[model samples]
Target: MKSSYLRASAALACAVVLTACGGDDGQLLLSGTISGVTKPGMILTNNGGSDFEVPVPANGTGLTRFIFPNRISSDDKYDVRVKSTPTNVQECKLFQNTGRAGFDVTTIEIVCTFKTQALGGTVSNLKNDLILVNGSDRVIVPAGATAFTMARVAQDAPYGVSILANPAGQSCTVANGVGTMGPADVNNVTVTCAP
Candidate 1:
């Protein structure tokens, strides 16, 4: 009878311990929302670990969200940051990315901006007022001007520079003036005028 009582007592003790250590690990998932992601290659990190890349949405929604693979415990300090930005984007900034992991934090925001490059080149023998144009954008180069710049163009965009109006008493032509705008400024265009 005493052995049976001790066995029952041991079972009760095991139940109590199991109840105390429940299934609640208390880890929370971390995620964020993103917008203006024009190109792929956006990589994110959490506490300098758990690196992951946020791909550009193929559904054409522009990547409305993302999630981290790692989880954090309640009240644990967390730091999330962008490791790299997409191509054609100047930078990606994170908002509300740092805080204590008290709950499932999903309000983090990421915004990105496109990179722009200036379209300019050297001009020689420009003795009279001249008008240059790239699409609707125009630039009026005064007499004796050695160089000119159109308007800034977004990276990976197409640009075709041409002469809107030639100078009086002179005929000028543009060389290497038609191409796409790269990541750097274009300054190789040459314009030579003949009398």
Candidate 2:
């Protein structure tokens, strides 16, 4: 009878170990989509956890879905966010910045826009007035003015400078003008005037 009781106790211990090693039932998945990623390998995080790098498709291919690495429990709170942006030449913004992981949520989106740069520069050898033209906006630099600045110019936008009213018998010529603005500030644009 003692041997039979020992065997039953061992069987009970083995059952308890198997139950302890079973998979958890509380794990939930999280996923979403991303747009405006020109380059590949964007990263995302969960409540400051480890980053999950996103895969980029080949050229001419469309973007792919982003999924988290580990499953989260229902009791844990998650704030999904971008860990790092794409290495492309665009500026990305995230919609639905923060959300809770109560269930399997997958409605997050990221949109990106072409980054803008400043268009500005100094005026030198100016003996007459001139106007810098960007779209329909214009800025007049006085005859004796030595410097000028234009800000918030859109990327890849065309710009030019011309003599609005040259009354000082001086002809103005632009050195670094009449070109599409790049990703950085165009501060080297010089308008030189001479008699």
Candidate with maximal lDDT: 1
1-195: candidate 1 lDDT, tens digit per residue: 999999998788766665354533447988889887757788899888867888788776566688886677677677899988877888778899999987899999998777899888888888899999999998999999999888898787789889999999999999999998888988888878877
Instruction: Give the per-residue Cα lDDT of candidate 1 at 44.
Output: 91
lDDT of each: 0.84, 0.69
Residue-wise C-alpha lDDT for candidate 2, range 1-195, written one tens digit per residue:
999999998788766665455534446777777765555557888889898887775553335677787876555566777777654436667776466667876777766555667777777777767777666667888778887876566555567755465546777777776787766788887877776
Clashing pairs in 2: none
Model 2 weakest 10-residue run by lDDT: 17-26
Candidate 1, overall lDDT? 0.84
Residue 21 alpha-carbon offset, candidate 2, angstroms: 7.6
RMSD of 2: 7.2
- Candidate 1 off by > 4 Å: 1-29, 57-64, 69-78, 86-90, 100-106, 114-118, 125-127, 135-137, 152-154, 164-172, 192-195
Candidate 2, lDDT over the whole model: 0.69
